[model samples]
Target: MGSPPWAADPAPASRLPATNLLTIEYPGYIRDTSDSLDRALVSLSPVAGPRVDAASSAYALAHLTSLLERGGRVVECRLPSGSGVPDAMDLYKHPILGDVTPSDHVVVRVHRQVWKRMVNGQEERRKHYRIEVLGASSTCIRFRRMADYAFRPEMPAHASEHPTMKLHKILEEMDVAAMHAHRFMPEQEDYYDGQGAQRRSNLAMIPPPFFNRQELPFYYGYRQNPTSSLQTVTFASTSKRSRRTARKGDADLLDAGNDHAEVTRYLNRARWRNMAPVAVKFTEDGPVPTEPDAMLAQMALSERQLAYLERLKKHLSERPVWSRLSLLNQFSVADARALVQTKELFALVAYTFADGPWRDALVRFGYDPRQDMASRFFQRIHLRGKAPRAPTTRGAFKAEYGQASASGKAAPAVGDAQARPATHLFDGQHSTFSTSTFQLCDITAPVLLPLIHAEGPSDLRSAPDITTGWYSMSAWEAIRSSVSKSFHALLSEAGPHKTSEEAIESSEGSGAGDSSEEDE
Candidate 1:
């Protein structure tokens, strides 16, 4: 097959430009999550992509062989761990902690046999299900039972001016019950009207431009007339001198560069864009699905006497941690939320193709996914616009409602930027930070690609608009360059247009045909 035009290595394009480095900082109540184990693990180069640590579960099903002074051995469940990385957490064990061996302070190695056996265990059974299906797994049904216990949005009775703290209090009290939702789906604008498009859009194949969210000011807060975001940073894989500094197995960083362009605006400092977004939920062509009521049945915010899914912050908070993590049953949720916000803020940036700072960060810190890499970086963030808040009153809230707050607001949104962010999240000397350079395209594309390529949900391709032409690199253009020269190259190279209007069946009773029209 002809080379996949859109495919590019995620690194510098062999040449070095000294002007690429940039320092971006922001001002506002920002919550950073690299400190948390769960989030920190996402930054690691392990797993399918960045994901929740295998060990960061509601319970760590460790098998303990404890021996008392009497020389009797007993086993029991260990307290669930909050640490995020499965690899790091895999190191510490109660036996190791309780070891009476002479090399007490040493980081003794656990046998691979023992380690595998310890982390090994079946997931929780779906006892939480409303009803058990003969073939359904336990994990499948528990959300129905556990919904009441997850985080619900929390709104305070009295209005508060601190934005960060208010968000912190609100999230802490909310129940973000878990769901088995398929995350990011790419727009297949890059597809070269060939078998790929005919069989499935695989969204990534379609070509489009990126949206500069700063264009819309709500997420940016008070920022305005921000500097143009430096555009695509191309990385070369075989630079003689570049290899001088290349890591042992480093690949081209260009693809990562392209992907970041789609996501960086969300991470750009809010001071540049000046906006605010109230809620986040996950959705599709229609409205976002209501969370399972079971997960919403119990929540931490409800215990605080606050209303559910409520936002009471009118100002930034002095305490960043509180705004981020105090609310979730698992540390992963809070960490994921914080990363999403940071990414959204970065998205606001408008990059100029000539010199992209976003590219520089990747260069300094490579984003290649190696299982052994200690410090990995993840730029993917998901967000969605929430429905308008329903009218609410403090008086209507019921004491026994079982919801975090009884305000009756609509559910918050989840994003697909897998839509990534902006904001000062904090005040600093500069609105941005200077970090290692990267292969932006590689980072963004490879992650979503599975959804964009061979096996992604087909519908995921057509609906979401990736705004490809707007991107400076036009990685799509580069990809298309490999495919053909013209905008309608596929029409010329493959065959005639053969407009589907002539082929589509017009039977009036065909609901499936009507749905296809809706998709179109």
Candidate 2:
């Protein structure tokens, strides 16, 4: 019934006064020997921001706290005999931020800590890579090969031996197996041979609630006819009349008001900062039967498919809103197959929408997509395994969506024109495993129509899920502890430990905290 040892006392937020020194506890460092390891630490002087005040009640520490909030895991590591100090440069960069190099020691530290967490009965829900070092003839040599890939040595197949690359290959094999398992399901075949099979594609936009809101922008609002399902309406403004009229037409019309703030913020960021993803194409093949799956099963010949496709022109027209289809156009066969294994259609679509075509598309359609904000969006989704609920208050919005760098300026946005949309993160070879994208859609039918047509109240249930919260609670606790112990100690007179009297009174309130990083 008591709190866990990992849990902090219900300390006052104002308990700590202000300080300028920022100390970062990096993930554990690697030991030279298999049996030992060292934990890295780096302290930043003259922390970024205005002059601090001692009377500011720990609030002035926000600048450093934000950075630490974005930092990686806090681990306790023991050093082996005569191990050198970890490079302070590595200590300064968070693993997720691309500051550290791929050395055998770093890889081992990452791997060992990851394995320890997994074996300790902690559940991992986020998508990531896992490197296996157990039972190898030589762990150092095996990891060194992995380091080659990590450091981008042009050693041909040797680079593939790197842990990151090897992990990617292992996942690739698993993905191939999954795609094969789902091969019998009805969908278009992506053939590489020049057999000249008629190729047709369709695209539709799944708005919020049904689609991952993290990926897609809620830009346009839809109005459905209550009298008949055949007629639909589209509105492009933020007004009460529009809302009232939309409700009259279809009570389930997605409330733009619900997503207005987030959409507006990103739209502004895109317009001002020019941080956008590639544009989504507006082309379309004619629509087929509303029941595309049923129609696809019966289309025995290319002629019948063409006939059904032509019939779709009556209902299908180019209604341009940012979409995931654009992103998918960039997905490689291997990537698609890999994503299919997770069977999380929402995640697949969301990732595509967030970075692929949707970012720029949102810009073209009157939204600002901040590269920094967009990066944060994807990172949190990866860490939390779900999107944060859009906060209701202006204060909540800043608190929830504020940048970790807290630089008071936007993170520089880069044009991904030369960047391959098919791959992201880690030398453009390893995609972020934060979410899954493997779903089979009948290329022969309307893709977004079915997703957009969810029935009843289920459509508006776009809030953060309870399952993701529970699974990620431990990670959140670890972060909270860092703030309490590290930052709090810096600002407060009381340190991370309790006195004898305090310990006895709070002895029952103790349990182990799961501080290990989640492996893919």
Candidate 3:
């Protein structure tokens, strides 16, 4: 049961191109390969967002981070090797961005002690290319979720405060409309403002989760990293505020009333004017936290949330409401029986006009086609593996009337048509791993109908098998007859002693010519 020593080779030497960065004479001390590599690497990322990917909390902690501008270069002020500034100028300008030669390194340092806690033992659920290095290659890079897609802000009333925060607020207020409106464009603003008619601006409306000062500097170097630098949905947002301030006066306006009043006072008053270093405390969470800080943390639930769930649970326990629901809500039914003290009141609904009135109502009322086509519908059928006690939606129909046979070790039941549809039933009663996966296979369905999706690997079943049995024998006879006729024709063309006859005729002609020559 233990892991073997052979399983733990921790070297990535195969991924690196060369072990060292040799300063060579190319492209005015060109990073031609590095530049090209970075662009190619970043194009594959899925990390674009306002600020960060929150759910990737586990992975982001394990690695170093940086940003990559379009042109291949790190723009951070200092690097991990502690390079103060990069050593090239022509590397700044790109053809698309009109030549921006890579010129800096972005450095972010976390104590190596805490590094293991973040990235260790995560189960990888996706596929990615593994970059192999050539020498003393200690570089371990992977595309954190890609983040560099262009997104125009829906300019909230307060967007000018700070771009990322504005986006954070927008996401917190996320609706289908806002997400649907999101567009990814490649071009940033032109380098010069209107061909010198106006002032030039280098600032880009970087999507939410901008990098820290040290991070931007190292952007170019990280861009070329094939393994991890691709922007992806996995690349989460940065945790802390960098040293850079978005605006001078805007901070005061944002911190108007609460706890940061003291910090704001220090910023505002004469003490700072004479001499005040203005102490600042940084937190992973923003300026204020929900807890009062007397206790380390609080488990206190929000009154609104607790009350809503409580009353809703209570109402469902009542007679008419309880009778309306199906067996799937039994855990609540059990709890509701305990809460209001009435099993008679919360008796599960036995049979109905429709298996699910509410879901049908949603369809009747008009659900969006995209929402109607969402995978959740498919999962409801494929996931149950056996059928539910109450059936609703297209997936239910697709599973029952459409599927051929339950072939998976874990697929839903492929019972005959006589079995009652059981969409109303609870999942646990039929959910044993022995009978757990419901797969369907080896049955023919209505011709031209799409087959039911397999729930797992064991569910792979072949299409209706059409045996080409007796027909193959008849085709063989036809082939035999054709071959016999061809053989006879070939024999006729070869006629007996054909080559000898031609030789005899040629010899006779030669003899006659000799006789004539002799007479002459």
Candidate 4:
């Protein structure tokens, strides 16, 4: 009652007697096709069992199958025709197995077989199998005894040594000398001996920065103040290394020689690197008023700026127009510091021509290039050689200008007559004429000065003549035609002995016969 039959102790299992069984292995699958077994048995007989002829191979197979079934369970497994068992068996024919013969027929040894009972109370034995065939050729057939070799699973692939491991070892043993001797290292001797000389020659040809030490006259009086008081305090040495050494030794007896050398080296480097020109900052201290009076009242202009403005106006009044370089040259000689704030001072009294005949020239604000015949006279003329001698005699002048006017062309103006002689006299002395002559083109259109907002009688802004409608195409053409006529008449006055190139050069050198003095 306490322990039921369900909990009874389990009986010891009986062991089956061991039998010596021969497993006759086939190299591939065995199919149930007619003569399939007979052919296989005949081919395998020479290597596996007793030798049998083709006529008695079928009887030999039946006897072998019977003996195998008596000792062990004879199993039949019906595999699908598409099963890849035949292809897997082909792997055994590899050369690794030693002297494998190629066979059209594949053999498979039965390991485990399955049988099924049908619903109709019938015992079904599944024995049908399939094998791959290349062709019907007899030579394509292969035969082998499936021995202990076929039962061995494929040997695991051996792990290969990394390719970089050897390179790593070589690098570990490499020294600085070995690295320098390697093919990748640049040829140092060739670089320093041959290419170095060539490089130095090339560098010598290049003009050194800041070699032209001619100080800009405009910035003569302008001095940049040190940002901090510490900058003004000069020490024996500024270098970190020098100071460190000085602190360790007698500080009062610091070596001045090393400090001087350091300073020289720094100065050289600073000179080379300081290529950018000094820039003047024009600061707006207050809001700009539109009226001239209001601007004068509110503007934070200094006495120096006002004085410079008056000087610029005086120069402009005398000539009306001047090239930027010529103005600089004149101011540079007269008062080197006068144009320290050149751009700012010029903005008040004159406006520069951006392009056209008077390009780069500062014209007085009121002068209009469009209507001014003088502006048209200045054209860029490329002169190849030296200028011809000017006509010294009055007879020569009459023969040229007087006869040209008599031929119905316009006569040259009195201003033109007088100005030409003066330009000729100074043509040789002026550097402008030595290389190329610079002429000021007459102002035609009025230049707009956005910076100038003077509204009183002293207003610098030149009002355009709206009645003429200068903006119109017809008006523009008329202006252009008038300029051309005047320009041609002026050129005709040059003697026939002068070539076109010489005439052009002469006209440029003459400064369009304007009485304005040439820039010194």
Task: Give the best candidate by TM-score.
Answer: 4
Stretches of candidate 1 off by over 4 Å are: 1-287, 300-308, 312-429, 434-463, 466-520
Error of 3 at 260 (Å): 87
lDDT of predicted model 4: 0.36
Residue-level lDDT of model 3, residues 209-286, one tens digit each, is 333212123345434323322121111111113112323543443332342332111122211121111111211123
Error of 1 at 494 (Å): 51
lDDT of every model, 2 decimals: 0.24, 0.28, 0.27, 0.36
Q: Candidate 3 lDDT (Cα, whole model)?
A: 0.27
Could you say which candidate leads in lDDT? Answer: 4
**lDDT for each residue of candidate 4 in 1-520, tens digit (9 for 90 to 100):** 4987867877755443233223333445667885566454543322221111222455545654563446432221111124422322222232111112223333333444565668678787776554332223212222231222221122112314222222232455766665455432222233233344532111101122222223223446764443312121124434456355333334544456543332221122122221211111112123222222223234456787777667777887787766544454444222423454345555556555434445455667666555554343332222232333345434533322222233344654323222122221112212212222344232221211111111333322232222221123343333333333223323346323223334335555655532222121
How far is 16's C-alpha from truth in model 4 (Å)?
A: 81
Better of 2 and 3 by TM-score: 2
Candidate 1's displacement at residue 414, Å, is: 33
- Could you tell which candidate, 1 or 2, scores higher by lDDT? 2
Q: Comparing 1 and 4 by lDDT, which wins?
A: 4
Please estimate how well model 1 matches the true structure, expressed as its whole-model Cα lDDT.
0.24
Model 2 segments beyond 4 Å from truth?
1-241, 244-420, 424-470, 476-520
